[model samples]
Target: MSGIIALLDDVAAIAKVASASVDDVVGQAVKASGKAAGAVIDDAAVTPKYLQGFSAKRELPIVWKIARGSLFNKLVILLPVALLLATFAPFVIPILLMIGGAYLCFEGAEKVWHKINPSDHHSEELVSEKLSAAQLEEKKVKGAVKTDFILSAEIMTIVLNALPQDVSIWMTGASLAVAGIIITIVVYGAVALIVKADDVGLHMAAEGNSGFVQSLGRGIVRGMPTVMLLLVVIGTAAMIWVGGNIIVHALNELGWHLPYDVIHDLAVGAAASVPESLAGAVEWGVTAFLDGIIGLVLGLALIPVVTKLIVPLSSWLFPEKQATPH
Candidate 1:
């Protein structure tokens, strides 16, 4: 009858609205993920190191445990905190972003400094020597999860900052949840593959059916070290670039436009010289390059402050307990 037809139309309209909302959530989630690329990459790059000394059998389980902790960090702890901030004290967001950005720059710069002036510190190894296998695994997992909390906080904050200011709380929550799950899966999934690659290669080298397969396996085993090094380098560069970009943008938001203006002009000038087809790419590259330079300089300046003042103060305030070797 006519009543039934009207109800059908109403249901169809509701479905349309629901579908549009879902699409919006997904779109925002993807965009937010892109904004946190530096942290995500660093997470992936750093996680494999925790697996370095563990037997192959324990690697995947440890990765799984860490991944679960990362998820809890983002979803349970950070997501709520981010939402509360956006709701009650939105002004604090940019300050937090700057702090996180500065941290990224400091970490990236420290890596560069260490590379230039390598020093052997076997503190972890020394500690590990004292613990049983199970205890060592527990300790490493705890350390990794603790590190993940910092990175996860940065990722969540970046995602929240990337969202539109007018979005509803529900929309914001959905976007963050989606972004967190996507990033966690991607970072840990990649870590799993990276850690397992060597074992796979070794297995192939030993047990492959044919010479060609065995040779390919051998190549993989030989190539993994170079791949790990490349990943670390890439991660470091990403941290510096993203950190610098965040700082400059934060400064611009806070009404100091000098750095922003200078960088924009430089990018524009660089783009002008390139072919029209390559103009956009050239501009982005130039901007990223400048941002990285700023980050490196800032990071280098912070190193001595962090080492001389911050580290000493922290150690004094919360000195670590020395464990006697069993």
Candidate 2:
């Protein structure tokens, strides 16, 4: 009986330790996830565009497929790669992170450039001529998944960097896993709602039993475009700001601290001019705006390189045949 009580006490201690570890993992995951908010917002914002031309009934299913792919990207691919970096190639994390940051800068800049010079922006037309609905869905899913891979890579790296260095390997993994799941659900769930809002509104407008309900439905339908535009604008700004910040911080890590210091000084100076209540907000806004400008400049520089060199190389490597019209 004494032996049993001793064993029970040991088990209780183990349970307590396990509970603490779980709490730690959850806390770390939430904190790290917050660091990747910009990327996550961009991801959520960007996804709705892919669903734009699809039929109403097909929207949720497509979102589900993309969400599944995103989960797979985060869990099956990025999670392992992040763990490998943490375990073995820890030194390379910063390098990979910078690369991702540069990509974001390029992307954001390209968006700004495209907005300024819309005529210059072009994509290899997805010749979906003969594709049936199922085929089209498959292609879109594949494209979304490909896009998700890039964004997910950025998110995972950012999260990994944000985590404490002293946590156990499993704890780190668990944190990442939790972050991935939570982010996936939040982003896709929001996308799903955004995409379906119009449909819901239309249904309510056309079929609602009350005048107020119908009016609300109309409002939703009309408001969707503005909401989408807002999302895009916010997402682009976030990408540029976050991308530039990442690059600045990465350069600092590499001992190039001038840009970081200058930006900090500028932010401080800007903050000094504002009221105490708004000082922080003003400072952050100024910093973000400057970072976006930096990102835009970098992206504009990369555009010529990407279009003239990268695109040609990619096309040469994977030439596409003409598709027959349906």
Q: Rate the local accuracy (lDDT) of all candidates.
A: 0.88, 0.85
lDDT of 2 at 117: 82
Judging by TM-score against the true structure, name the best candidate. Answer: 2
Task: Give me the overall lDDT of model 2.
Answer: 0.85
Tell me the tens digit of each residue's lDDT in model 2 across 1-326. 99999999999999999999889999999999999987898799878877767898899999999999999999999999999988998778777767877787787777788788876654323346447888777887887787778789889988998999988889899999999999999999999999999989999999999999999999999999999788778777776777787788788887889988888899999999989999999888888878777777877788899989987897778666323221
Summing lDDT over every window of 10 consecutive residues in candidate 2, give the lowest-scoring window: 317-326
- The C-alpha TM-scores of every prediction are 0.84, 0.88
RMSD of 1: 3.3
